[model samples]
Target chain A: MKKRDHKECVSALLPVKDTLDLIGGKWKLLIIISIWEGNKHFREIERSIPKLSTKVLAKELKELEMNKLLHRNVIDDFPVRIEYTLTEHAKSLKTVIGTLHSWGLTHRKAIFEK
Target chain B: MKKRDHKECVSALLPVKDTLDLIGGKWKLLIIISIWEGNKHFREIERSIPKLSTKVLAKELKELEMNKLLHRNVIDDFPVRIEYTLTEHAKSLKTVIGTLHSWGLTHRKAIFEK
Candidate 1:
């Protein structure tokens, strides 16, 4: 890689707000994590996540697909089947989510209950 | 850590939306990353981040402090100075944010322009 300047490097970052803007919705991250468990079909994702209205689930899924974080493959059949997978980009979120999970554990014990 | 069951382990993870709920706002992660650069105090943080309205900065800082991600130590003196530092819990985010930065680079090259 070529040597990049400080300004160049900083500008290269995904704007933090844009990052959140893409994944910040109420269902985006959960939808990603739900698919993370290998459930892919719409009904499967809906079933895995309790109380998720179909409308919201569809909306979130389309958004995730648009952002390239999740892939929606439509299987041709009597009833179309859609399977979702984490893009390589979305896989990067695993580390982020893992750290968040760790923080949650620590926060639950130390901060939340207090 | 004790050997925990599947449900217990899963429950231990923060709800993904809640994680976003805490840090997924317009200014939260930027505020965190701004403070990540060793700039402390209301003024220094303000100066480091351009175009950030003071009201929003103050509000985000207070929220970050309440979440224990940032510390506000008021220095008792003539003018009374306050500084912010990332808590140890916040340090865990380094890996997560680093991964995000890397993904941004790759995404810019591979996906965003397409």
Candidate 2:
């Protein structure tokens, strides 16, 4: 098979870069996964991901919200409660995260059993 | 559906963390894709990725080789041609990268056309 040219490689890479730019960091995807798994509050999301501190979680949440991947809702109550949910756009990441989770699981076995 | 507890969440996130630790940087996947596309030599890989500096490419290649995600071969030629290839372990990432590529394409359209 003929090798892809430099131009083809770069074109294929650009969209992946866009995805990474939005959700590449160590904490971003973990937080997304946690929230997707039903950690609706800031503290709950924080506790779900190990070693993710309050400060970093707060920052990541803000970034996710800014990027429209997360929705921050304020519920009306005696004490107003804040909730976080994955936006419709963010739901588009289900397959990406699922694939990563499976690959990660297999990768762990591959690395350890060899 | 029952929400995953913190402990369960942490358990699930650990393998993902393991995978990320191995291949979670900005340029690592891009480099892998380039080599997989038959950019055998270092120069070819370097040229395939846009805006990637020689210094960063060199460093990323070293890390990938050390992680066993890449294999470097020195061909016995007049100039001792050096080549790069993705390892079997790295080939496991095809699904993960494919999912990301498709998600990214959709995401770009979602973000821009909205």
Candidate 3:
């Protein structure tokens, strides 16, 4: 590749690498989806995603919070309750998630049709 | 969660899970990006991705091909040259990749500003 092309490729890939670094796991996006779909509490998220253990869910949620994708809120009531909500930054992932969801549906249909 | 809500969550997660199953790793999307950016040869891709090993690259390439995201073309020359190209299906990931790339840029800026 030419020096210019190489530079371009590097520039193009930097953010992509960063994005993957943020959301490249099996559960992160799903967790985001779960919260986006209105499952805010810990138990709700846990029950929503089948096979995701509490340990993994907790870890993923903390990471998501740290990244500012979602924020955690604690209710001061007779019984303390926590809610997870997506930030605008996280809500921006709707396009990415929608594209993946649509592509996945097509991919699944193609595989099954074969 | 109510019974209806549980069923809705399951339906919503199925395709997302399938999508993750297809492209969950650190390397697959990068490999696709590498090819899309004009790194068609094995050595070019390896050179472009700073830390990718040959073994991993080869494995990713095969998986991408098997998933119909790309195709391999062998040129019948004095010493056989192999070229990899993205299929239409793979090209469709542009929106997905673009979204990630844009989000990544913002995400990186946000982190640095913190």
Q: Pick the candidate with the highest DockQ.
A: 3
RMSD of 3: 4.8
lDDT score at residue B12, model 2, on the 0-100 scale? 52
User: Mind sharing the TM-score for model 2?
Assistant: 0.86
Residue-by-residue lDDT tens digits, candidate 3, B35-91: 888888999999888789999999988988887788999989979999999987778
Tell me the alpha-carbon RMSD of every candidate.
4.1, 5.1, 4.8
Error of model 2, residue B110, in angstroms: 1.2
Per-residue CA lDDT of model 1 for B37-101, tens digit only, reads: 77787887787666788999999888887877888888899888887899875776676566555
DockQ of 1: 0.37
Write down the C-alpha DockQ for each prediction: 0.37, 0.55, 0.58
Query: Candidate 3 at A84: error in angstroms?
Result: 1.7
Tell me how many residue pairs clash in candidate 1.
0
Q: Flag regions of model 1 displaced more than 4 Å.
A: A1-21, A50-55, B1-21
lDDT of 3 by residue, A14-103 (tens): 788888888888899999998888899999999988899999999999998988888999988969999999988788888888888887
Scored by lDDT, the top model is 3
Model 2 residue B113 lDDT? Answer: 53
Question: Which digits, one per residue and each the tens of the lDDT, describe model 2 over residues A16-111?
Answer: 777888888888888887887778998898877778899999999999988889899999896999999999888888788777877777776666
